[model samples]
Target: MVYTLEVPNTYGYVVLGAGVGSVICNIVLGGPVMKARKQLDVPLPNLYATPGVHKNADEFNRIQRSHQNYMEMLDSYIAMTLLGGLQHPIACAVGTVFYYIGAILYQKGYIDKSLDVDLARYKKGGALKWIGFFTSMYSTCALAYTMITAK
Candidate 1:
């Protein structure tokens, strides 16, 4: 009824990488949003541009929202990846990849000006987003269960 407390070195590294990668992705995504805000003349402290009031407001809003959406999920993703990596590194790693890929695709689709459907383009990456989120959730739960049951 004993358990080893050590996490595999590779697993630890993978977890660290996932966390760092998420931050880096967020930072990179933000650059475009910042540039769009400046170029489109979106002022600071305004969460969003007024529809039809600001020139190209929709475009700038979309760009900003894409980055904001990623930020919204970043904290949870990092936490799940770290906790889950303790028990299931491979699963967490895969989940991280899925999430990032999905996030990027979602961002691209959301920011595309050609799409006239407003937020509908997010559907393009919605499936992967769910899959990745669930995967991480499962792994994190497994880690919790293991810790509680361990002797």
Candidate 2:
């Protein structure tokens, strides 16, 4: 007998939510970058403001790096959330929620003038990030393992 994989019908909603959330996250994080770009006169093709040459360079760099850093891992987050949701919707969804919460906090901590001095402020979000990432990763691995061993 072969074990067949079955995904819940409602999981589709979870996937769609994740997609919408991703777009929202992108916009939320990127908005400041665009504002900083115009304010700082960071022209196209030059991704970041020069540390010494540009006024308010430190702040601009923080904003840019926060957005850039999030984007760097977004694809993985989406993949894990969606794929893992196929078999473990609740876990994936919960993980995604935590991840986004962490992301927002992480961005806030990085850019907050009062908190910027302590780079460790970002660690608070980082912990939540790992919780989410690992949950999805575990789900994905579980799904893969189930599929592979199914006969």
Candidate 3:
């Protein structure tokens, strides 16, 4: 029996695996978790408000639109990750670049006022919160590993 030594292609494999895992996990658990969070009867703080009067119906609708846009951004990001993982090395490179850009933006307070009050209610130190945190952490780690291992 001869064992041939092939250098482990860690980067390619990790990216592909993480991408597939993210798509599956999000599709399976994301909707249900979001729905449950919506059911929580908590009032979210208003991040945006004009000086005098509170937000009118139209303003509230605008805020909802922003949230929808954010969700769409997330969907595209995950899709990109999966596509990169399954495609050429360029995809992995793109994924790595996007990750770093997001990290930098996050560090610079680009996302500070983006949290919704109702969504925060679900993160009140319970099983759901832990699960959410762990899932995010795992995904982050997977992406980081893939980026680091890519040649």
Candidate 4:
């Protein structure tokens, strides 16, 4: 006799898991990675010397701390969703795909200086910037929501 594996209706759990995962990963791994990249490009001391440097630094540190909290929160959230069990592999896989795609776009030139306002206005009212902006936003939201809601 031939046997086949059965799949469970875990879409809701998957979505929530992925959503929580994305948020946690983005906060923990993604934020530091992006900050490191920014440090390479602009350097931290230079960042410290900017007009609102103190305020900015405070905000940045707050965000970093928040990411750490988010990571811990994810553990609890996942456990709650999974009920002390592992998440479905398919949901994890799909979440990973979305996470990487967003990461790549963000790491590329999508959020660079050329896309900033003065240049955007100079180059005819920011069509490309807006497109990129919307794309990033949509991708991020979809990925987060899908991860959170997947069962």
- CA deviation > 4 Å runs, candidate 4: 1-7, 11-29, 36-56, 84-151
Worst 10 residues of 1 by lDDT: 117-126
lDDT of 3 at 87: 30
* Candidate 1 regions with alpha-carbon error over 4 angstroms: 1-4, 116-119, 123-126
Among the numbered candidates, top TM-score falls to: 2
lDDT of 2 by residue, 1-151 (tens): 7777688886875586588887888888888889888998887777888977788888888888878877899888788878888899988888887887777777777888767446743654655777888888998898889888887
Q: What is the lDDT of residue 67 in candidate 2?
A: 80
Considering summed lDDT, which 10 consecutive residues are worst modelled in model 3?
A: 103-112
- TM-score, every prediction: 0.83, 0.86, 0.29, 0.31
Model 4, poorest ten-residue lDDT window?
A: 120-129
Stretches of candidate 2 exceeding 4 Å from the true structure = 1-3, 116-126
lDDT tens digits, residue span 1-151, model 1: 6666678665965565576778777877888888887898888888788987789888888888887888887788788878788877877777777887788778788888877646655756745766777888898899888878987
Q: What C-alpha lDDT do the candidate models reach, one value each?
A: 0.78, 0.80, 0.39, 0.41
Question: Local error of candidate 4 at 127, Å?
Answer: 32
RMSD of each: 2.5, 2.2, 12.2, 11.3
Candidate 4 lDDT tens digits, 1-151: 4333344565554555456556665654455535743653435444222335343453344333333433444444443334321324444434444433443333332223445423322243223323323333444455556556666
Pairs with steric clashes in candidate 3: 44-117
Model 1 alpha-carbon miss at residue 5, Å:
2.7
